[model samples]
Target: MEPDIWGIVWLSLKVSAVAVGVCLPLAFALAWVLARGRFAGLVLLDAVVHLPLVLPPVVTGWLLLLAFGPQGPAGRWLEATLGVTFMFRWTGAALAAAVMALPLMVRAMRLSIEAVDLRLEAAAMTLGASRWRVFCTLTLPLALPGVVAGAVLGFARSLGEFGATITFVSNIPGETQTLPLAIYSALQVPGGEAVVTRLAVVSVLLSLAALVVSEVMARRMGRATHVL
Candidate 1:
């Protein structure tokens, strides 16, 4: 392995973890709203949530840039108020990754939430649990398998996200340069074939490991739920 391999691996894991961590609770809330709420424009909201799936990655990156670039509304306000900048930074990379993974997260969480038997939640309420408590104590636990699957998949996707990362964060090494970005950069240089090949192998291993982990987690959650 190259001396930088460990650094690359660590960077990928940290960025993907941050992306999933930031997206998970928001995904759960959105999923809950979609599953249990009867609000106007919900269909529209769902469409917006799923839009990134259908949109090109480069286009999504551009949209993120327009919304969160240093001079952009949200980014500018944060810079002025908090003295933090996102453009071309690792945080920007994570934000791009989170956006790219959000659709999958929402879909998985929403499906799991919908599959939750409302009758069980109602039964908990009949036993005098409040709605929020019922969700925490009964419904959320029931759908944890899908949540774990979704989070793992999102992390895997974030690890490979390239166009969005490059467009948003510009591939600064040891900064915004994730595994995919590092691989892409290597491919653009003369006699970089060996490094690119090694990175590709690393990418495949990481993705495969994530998949296996996710499957095991889902199965474990399913078994636990059954045992309960």
Candidate 2:
């Protein structure tokens, strides 16, 4: 492969990896709450968490832009407080990918958390263990496989993310030009079919690998649930 192609591939992987890493903990927290929390407006929280799944990618991207653009409120706050910027940056691409992938990650993890025997948690608490301790020692361990699966799913989704990323980050080469963006760019150029094909193949292979790993983790989650 050409060095340019390699760079696109690497950037895609890096963005997707960072997206998943940044999203996993938040996804897990939401999943646990959806699975176990009993609160008013829980349904509303779930709906908000899943809004990205129903929204058009372009719309989601646009919303992200309005919220994270340099002049936007969140963007201005982040820049002013933390000296961080996401506009037209690779980090912005990762943020877009993470938003797009959040629903799937939370759904997978919620299923796993819900499948965990509540009885075990109660028993642990009965033994003088704090709620946090029960969560860390029993709940999290039982749900580990599902968390891994959710991360894999998020990674796959991030790898394929295009519309939101392009809209938010503008597809800068060697910066925010992930695989899907590169493929889109290639499609516009005359005689760039080869580049498109190569990148598409890599994207498919990476997505397939992520799916396979997620499947394995899901099976492990099932076994753990069965044992419990």
- TM-score of every model versus the real structure: 0.93, 0.93
Off by over 4 Å in 1: 1-3, 223-228
lDDT of 2 at 91: 94
Q: Residue-wise lDDT of candidate 2 within 86-158, one digit each (tens)?
A: 9888999999999999999999889889988999988998899998899899999888877887888889899
Q: Which segments of model 2 are wrong by more than 4 Å?
A: 1-3, 216-228
After best superposition, candidate 2 residue 28: deviation in angstroms?
0.6
Q: Cα deviation of 149 in candidate 1 (Å)?
A: 0.8
Q: What is the C-alpha lDDT of each candidate?
A: 0.85, 0.88
Every model's Cα RMSD, please? 3.0, 2.8
Q: Native-vs-model 2 lDDT?
A: 0.88
Q: How much is 120 displaced in model 1, in angstroms?
A: 1.0
| RMSD (CA, angstroms), candidate 1 | 3.0
Model 1 lDDT per residue over 1-228, tens place: 243877888988899999999999998888888888898999999999898889888888888888888768988888889987878788888899999998888788888888889898888899999988997898888878768877887899899889888877788888888998888788888888899989899999999998878777767665521211
